[model samples]
Structures are given as C-alpha cells and as structure tokens.
Target: MSANGLPTDRLGGNYFKLFGASTISNLGDGIGIIAYPWLASAVTRNPLLIALVAVVQRLPWLLFSLPAGVITDRYDRRTLMVIANSIRAVLTLGVALIVLGKQGVLPSPDDIDAGAVIGTDGFLYGMVLVATMLMGFAEVIYDNSAQTFMPAIVHKGNLEKANGRLWSIEQVANTFMGPPLGALLLIVAFSVPFFVDAATFVVSAALIALIPATKRSAKQTDLVERRPWQVELKEGFSWLWSHDLLRPMAIILGLLNMLGTLSGATLVLFAQEVLRTEPYEFALLESGGAIGGIIGGWSASRIARKIGSGPSLYLTLLLGGLTTFLIGFARNWIFVWAMFAIFMFFAVLWNVITVSLRQSIIPNELLGRVNSVYRFFAWGMMPIGAALGGLTVVLTDAFASRDIALRMPFFVAGVLSVALFFFAAPKLTTERIEAARTGSG
Candidate 1:
C-alpha cells in the first residue's frame, strides 16, 4: 500500500515519471487550448479561416498516422517521445517569437468579439497553419509512441488503474489549471502563454529522457523484424480489420469524433457571439470538462464493473446526444458549462474503457502499429469533420441568422449520435469483450 492506501508496489518509478511529464505537457496544452483558438479568432472572424486552422492541425493524423505507427514500431519509444516533444518545444518557441513581433498590431483579447469585423492577418494566420500542422505531425508520433510506451512500464494487470490516474491528473492540468492561467497570460500579452507552453514542453522532454531504457523480450525482438514499412503497416491494418469488435468500435469512435468536431469547429465564435462570454468566462467553460473528466477518470472502472462495459458505453452514447442537444439550445454560458461537464464525463468514460480494453487485448509487438491504425480510423475523420463543420456554418449563414447557423452543427451532431447508438447496440457487448479478454473470441 502507498501513502494514500492505494497499491503502489505495482506502479514503479517510471510510471510516475511518465505521469508527471504528461501532466506538465498537458498544462501547456491547456494553455494552447485558450491561446490557439483565441489567436485565430482575433486574426479573422471568418468561420472558414478559423475552421481551417483546426483542419490543418488535424490533417497530419490522417496523412501521417500509418507512417508514424511504423516509426514507433521501428524506434525506441522513449527516445521517440523525447524527440517529438523537443521538436514541439522548438516550434512553439518560434510561434512565441513571431507573435511577440506582431503583438503590437493584433487585437487585444478584450476587444475581440464575435461581431468584430477584422481583416485576416495573412502572415500570422499562415504561420498558425504551418506551426499547427507541424505540431500535429509531432503530436501523432508522440501520442502513438506514448500509448505503446505505457505497457512497458506498468504491469498489465494495473493498466486500467494506471490509465485512469494518468487521465485524471492530465484533465486537471489541461482543463482545470491551465485554461485559467492561459486567460491570465492573455492579459499580459499573447506571446507570454506561448513562451510558457514552450517551457513546459522542454521540461516534459527532459523527464521522458530520464526513464531507463526498456529491454525487449526475445519473442518481441524476433517478431519486430526489420520488414519493409509497407509490409509492417499492412500487418497492423489486417489485425485490426480482422477483429470484429475493434473494427466497429474504431468506426464508431471515428463518427463520434467527427460529430464532436462539427460542433466544436466554430466553438470560439459561439462562445463569443451566441453566449456573449469574455475570455475568463470562456476559460471557466472548460473547467466543467475538467471536473467531469476527473470524476469519470477516477470512477470509470467502478462504473464499468457496476453497469457492464456495454451499458457503460451505451450511457456514453446516450448522454453524448442529450448533452449536445442541450448545449445547442443553451443561451447561458453556465448552461453550456453544465452540458460540457456532462458530455466530458461520458467521453472520458468511453476513453478509459475503450483504451484500456485495447491495451489489454492487443499483442505487445503490434501494439504501436495496431494502436496507430486504430487511431487512423479513430482520429483520421477529424479533419473531414472540421471541413464539414466550417462549411455547415458558412452555408447555414446564407439562409439563417449567424446565431442559428452557429447552433446548427450541435443539433445535427446530436441527432447523428442518437442514431449511432442504435447501430452500435448489437455489435459491442459485455460478453464479446470478456471472451476477447480470455483469448476465446
């Protein structure tokens, strides 16, 4: 038993190191959460341009996930994580410098509003696009490697517990602590938060570098032969496609992510215009997700055991539609806040269960490739969704009020989520999951 009376013997030093790095880096992400979107909104109120930033940011996942998987499988996972973060640090610093030079001309955070007619700062906007795309590529590699790296440090039996704890703290940093701080930093200057964000990446990279190298088993070594990239990629793709449960699950997640981006594509505008929120209030909006994520992360295992994995997932899908619809109709930021809290609770629940399930079932040698392929299905749709989301607003604005146009995506996404629940009901079940666990599926 550890100091908190929870088992710690099974979770060694490396797990804590990984946990700390994730937490600190997520703090930077939390800052970016406010800084990035707010910066885009300041540059141009055009919904398409704003959405383009998101599309470009996620484009790499679609383009690079398969190749990134191959790289993860080919290299040392820890070293890959360090290098990815280091690159991100460098790129973020460049953003800070660029923003510093232009801070004099950019609109003050307080003056930026949904109704403001601002000319697009082509130079800054282009830079945001390029930096986000590069960072997205780095994120793909770091994320794929990090997930695969987790299994090597912690015992398999403790995977759920470890993942749960990791996510909880990450949520706290990313949403709870970081956004409010980002809001404050914006008061100082746009570049200040980016500088802090860069520093956090540096710290995270150093921590990851300290983890001792993992020794591969003879079986894993033999399995991870130096094969052609195409062959290895095909192997991972075939494994996931052959699995009945994972195939549909990945597809379902892809649709869900698409729907999420659809509503979220123009969220900063919605918050500014529809909800009439200031920067601090907007940051407060994310706090709801932080709270929900914390609760869901800590309690997911218990919820899964109590309701069964199938029902837990059903709850996520069901609540996802309901909460999204509620947010569509909400005029007050507090109401939106409540919806965010509820929506994130189920979202984190889905992640905890699904991610843990994958880690438990997938073979070690194929973990990186398979997880990347799974993400390819899971995350690849985001850019597409982002594109549709932007188009949805622009097209809707032609016939309807801007407020109505802003709210349309949420309504559409809600209906799609409910329809998806019916489709997913039969495919994913507690029995199938248990059978897969026992190697009998």
Candidate 2:
C-alpha cells in the first residue's frame, strides 16, 4: 500500500515513470506559461500582436489534430512521446539562443508595464511565432499519445485515480513551483527561463525513452490489414459523430474552450494594465490555480459521485462564467486570484469526469484517433477565440477606455458560458453518460 492507502501494485513501475515525465514536462510548461507571455509583452504592447502569439501556438490543434491522431495510432506511442519532447528541447534551446542574442535590445519586463514602447524585433517575434507553432505541434502529438498511452500502462479501473494524481502533481509543478522559479529566472535574464525550460524537456524525454516499447508484434501488425489513412480517419470520426452523447459533448467543449480563450488571450495585458501586477505578483496569481487544482484533482471523483457527472459539468459551466465575469470587474490581483482558483477547481472537475469517461469507453485501437477528433472539435476553436479576443480589445478600445477594452473579453466570455450551460445541460445528463458506458461494455 502507498502512503495514501491505495494499492501501489496496481499503478505499476511504468506508470510512475510516465508520471515523472509528465510532472517534469508540466513544470517546464508552468515556467513557459509565465515566460512566454512575459516575453511577448516585452516584445510589444499591442493586444492583437500579443494575442497573435496565442493564436499561432494553438493553431496546430485546428490544423494538425486530425493528422496527429493518425500518427498516434500508427506509431509506437512511447517513441512518439520521446521524439516529440526531444524536438521541443531543441526548439526551446534555439529560442533561448535567439533571446540571448537579442536580450540586449529588448525592453525589460519592468519597463513594459510602465508603458514603455519598444520597436518590435521582427526576427525575434517571427522566431517566437515559428517556435511556438512547432512546439504546439509537438504538444499535440505528446498530449494525444500520452492520453492513449495511459490505458496501456494502468488498468481502466484506476484511470481516475492515476489521472487525478497525475494532474495534481502537474499543477503543483506547473503552477506552484514553475511560475515562481520562472519569475526568479526572469529577474536574472529573459534567456534563463527558456534555457531551463529546454533542460526540463530533455529530462522528460529521457524518462519517457526509458519506458519499455509498446509496439505490436510483426504477426499482430500483419494480422490486421493496414487501411488507408483516410479510411482510418473516417472510422474515428464516424464513431464519435454517431454517438449521441459524444457529438454534443465535443461541440459544447469546443464552445467552452472558445469562450475561455476569448478572455485568456489578452490576460497578460489585463494583468499588467488593469490589475497592475508585477512578475512576482503574477506568479502568485497563477499559484491560485494550483491550489484549486490540487483540491479539485484530489476530490473530483468524490464530487462526481456525490453530485453526478451531469451536475458536476453544469457547475463547471456556471462557475466558469461567474468567475470570469467577476474577474473582469476586479481592480485587485487578489480578487482575480480568487476567481482563478474557483475557475480552475471546476475546470479540473470537468476534466476528471470527462477524460476518464472517454478513456473508459473508447476502444483502445481507436482511442488515439477518436480522442484526436474530439480535441479537434474541442480545441480547434481556440485560435478563433484568440483572434476574437484581440479584436474585442481593439474594437472596444476605439470607443472605450483601454481598461474597459481589456475587460470586455471577460464580460463577453462570461455571458457566452452561461448561455452554453443551457445548451449543454440537456445533452450531457447522468443517464446518458451511464447508458453510454453500459453500451460500451
């Protein structure tokens, strides 16, 4: 038995290794969460340009998710994870070098918040865009494969436990530990965080590589005739679309994601201009999510059981709007931090229930493709939302104060989320979810 009183034998050695890799990589992601936006703000103050970086980073979900699903299904998933992280390490290293070369000319983070104007380095900004896009591609592969890879290492019964613990630790590393460290690194130099981020990727890649290969034997591969990519893709899509529950679930998630990015795309600016947060304060603000996520991750299963999956989801949607709307009106960082904590709590609740459901129901062979299609619908809208977020600020700025323009996205997102709750309430019921699970078995 583990310290938590759960049977350690069930989780297995490989799961821990995968867990370690995820934890390390997420810490880097946590650091990048601070570093990337701070770096963007230093490059330019234009809300649209800052939002553009977000759009480009998420664009791969829109453009590459389907193909990546196919790739995940075809390749050895562990190898795919290793290769993706290795590529990210090299790409991040290149970013560190580019930033190092140009750090002498870029405005300091302290200066940017004070309304200092700096001419954008076209080369550096372009590199940032290119690097983000590539990293996003790698992320798509790594994330999809990782999700599919989970069932291979751990039993289906323990998925929620495994995923919950995994996400909890990831949140701790990404939000709690990473952001503060990133803030300190930023104090030293812009290049320092990127270099550290690269190292994390290297370590994560090595850990994943150490896992035993999950490859099918030649006879197993030969037994199933390989179909064309288009056929396989269609099979995945058809299965998801034909399902009454999943089709709507995917659409509702897409809208929710869209609304999320609507406010989040320009949040760095809002923090700088409206909330008046410095790097340390911003890092502190992010830590709020970690606290919420830790609690949520540890308790999501209990919450779902107590309230039912459907009601849990409803709570997520309702709170999403409420928290975002509240955040828009706050002038203080502490208030925003509180809202972030609430927002992340329900966010993790939604993820724990839904992700575990999908993992439990989907056939292992098609899990990669179906999950990809699901994400394509769910995540593809982010770039569109990001673009709209930037446009909201620009258009609102024309008629309103900069502060109000920055706040508009949150108001708009909040309203949309409440509206989404009404639509989703009917489709994603407890009965439907249970019925689907029964039917799958």
Candidate 3:
C-alpha cells in the first residue's frame, strides 16, 4: 500500500523516520560492497587472496557478532547506531586518504602495491584488507542493534511492510548504485566514492542522534541477580535454542546460505570459462542480478500475501536452484547471461521473502541473539563455501576442463536447495508462528 492509503494511526511517525535513516546509511555500504570487492580482484589476481577479502570482511560477524547482540540489548540502540556509524566514518576517511595518495600523493604505480601497504614491496592489498575489516566490524554492531530496535518502533501489523521496505532500500543501495558508481569511481577517481561513503555515514550518525531510544518494559523484562551483561548475553542464545519455532528456521537459513554462497562463488568461473567473457563483461552479467534484487524487494510484500510467506520461500528457492543448473549448461555468452539474470531474479526474490518472513515471525526480545546465532552459522559458512567453490574449480581443473570445474558448484547447490524444500518446508507451518505473533500461548 502507498503511504497515503495507510492509516496514520497504524504507522507511527518515529518508525518511519528510523527506517528512512537506515535506508540512507545502507546505500553507502552498498556502494562499498561493489567497490571494495572488485577493487581487490582488479589489483590482486589470486583467487584465494581475493576470496580472503570477503572472509576478513565477514569474519567480524562471526567473532564480534554475539558480543554485539549482548551490547545491543543492554544499551540504547539509537545511541549505539550513532557510535557505530561515527567509527565507520573515521575508518572510511582513512581509506579515502590512502586512495587519494594512490591517485597523486604516491604518484607512482611503483609504490602502489608493495611499498608501504602489503610490504610485498608493492601491494596495496594489505590496506584494502584493513579497510574492509573495519567496515565489516562497524556493520556488525549497527545491524545487531537495528534488528532488535526496528521491531520495537513499529506495531505488529506493519512488521512485514517495515522489513520489506528495509530490504528494498538495501536493494537500491547494493544492487542499483553500487555497480555503476563503483565502476565509474574506479576509472575517474577511486578515492571519490570512499570519501562520499564516509560522508554518508557521518550524515547518518547525525540523523540517528536526533532520535530517542526505545523504553524497556520493567514488568515484562527479565531480571537477574548476576551481572546484567552475563545474563543478557546467555539469555539471547538460550531463547533461540529453547524455542521450537525459531530453531528450525535458523537451521534452514544457515543451510540455504551455504548453498547460496556456493552458487555466488562459481558465477565468475561460469562467466569467464563457460561464456568466454572478459572480467568487465562478467561484472556486467553479475550486475543484472542486482537489478533483479531491486525488483524482487519491490514485490516481496504482494507476493508474500498472495502465496503466504512459507510457500513463497519454497517456490522461489526451488526455482533459483533449477535455473542455476540450467545456467551451468548454457552454451554461449548470450544464453549464459540470460540464465544468470533469471537466476538472480529468483534467488533475490527468495531472499527478500524469506528474510522478511523470518523477521516478521521472530520475537523482538530475542532478535539480536537469534540474528547473531543465525549469522554465526548462516554467514559464518560463507567463506567456506567460497573456498570450496574455489577448491572445486582447482581440483576439477586438475582433471577436467575449466568449464566443468566452474559449473560443478551450480549443480551441487541445485541439489541442496531441492533437498531443503522437501526436508524443511513441510515442518515449517504457518500455525507454528500464529501463537507467537498473537502472544496468547
């Protein structure tokens, strides 16, 4: 529904402001996601090392994620967001300066890579890694708090719409502006987008500071004789494990994540080895999915209503897997590109639906810890999938053609996705969440 049609009584003013601020902050990160990874790939050709860039970036979610959840629960989430964004702004400023140096201050491609940065006598790869790690750390903190906080600001009825809008903004940030801006920034002034990104965070911090934190309910809130931090931390994890409904969903998301990452890692190989495309052209092929992601986010709410959230998840997940397999068999660049685009459309559509469904169904008190638990495994295995995808390429290359090596992962994930549907969906019923949402149980 349009903003005009929705009754003002159902949507709180503070909630809209909070989500709007989030959309802007997320847009900056989206640009960085494209810029940072491609920048790493361009300067360093080593597949394993390039993959390390993604690992170090995501590693924070594994290590600090649990602690971030604890902190989010104990403190003011609005203030926490401001602090996190401020720290990221400082880090982005540092990275931008380094880029500026590369453009002029260093003045020599000779000093670019191995001199002061990586110490390999010439690689800026080390600095790039540091920048990604910093941003990743900031993201972990911001996300943990936001997950918990957003649910508090809005009423139960608008939860799905709120989450869908957040995903939609992210789609624009990551998929829409990230590619063209990242590509153009690299060509014209590599440092420019980094500076602009830093500025966005600074602006986000300023805006977030204006909002007041949510008040906790003393009656319903848990009280512990021991230190609150210790209690809060364990409570989050305990709630997730003990809950019959959430446990299954968490496990399913983790397993699907592994499948998703496996397909993602193999995309490059498919484009380069199977389609015989250059890196730039391959990047374009990948960007087509980003477009699909944007479209998917826009449609998530309507689709969820039509199909119900659970069935929407099943169909999209299965369709994505089948199309991915078809992509592996495509004989030419045009066909492969067509398959990749459709693959992304379905994959992203699945993601938008599943994510909103989970967010809508889960308890707010358990949001941070549950999300962290979900991230710890769901996201924790991403690097492994990437590494394994690379390994499959390597091992397969040793025996078979590069095309076989590249397409192998697609087939594996296709099978996994299908299995997840059969094994998990029948058990995940709408009746399970109704009690939780109604609070009558």
- Give per-model CA RMSD: 2.7, 2.9, 4.9
Clashes of each: 0, 0, 6
Residue-level lDDT tens digits of model 1 in 1-441: 533333545788889999999999999999999999999998998999888888998899899999898888877899999999999999999999999999998898778853666899999999999999999999999999999998788777687888888999999999999999999998899999999999999999999999998876675565567577898899999999999889999999998898888889899998999999888888999999999999999999899999898888988888998899778898989999889989988999899889988988998888889999999999999998888888999999999999999998899889998998999888879898778777899
Q: Given candidate 2, what's the lDDT at residue 353?
A: 87
Please give the lDDT score at residue 410 for candidate 2.
Answer: 98
Q: Which ten residues in a row are the worst by lDDT in model 1?
A: 1-10
Leading candidate by TM-score: 1
lDDT of 1 at 384: 88
Question: Where is model 2 more than 4 Å wrong at Cα?
Answer: 1-9, 215-225
Estimate the TM-score for candidate 3.
0.83
- What lDDT does each candidate get? 0.90, 0.90, 0.66
lDDT tens readout by residue for model 2, 182-245: 9999989999999999999999999999899875646335424667778888988999999899
> Of 1 and 3, which scores higher on TM-score?
1
> In angstroms, how far off is 317's CA in candidate 1?
1.0
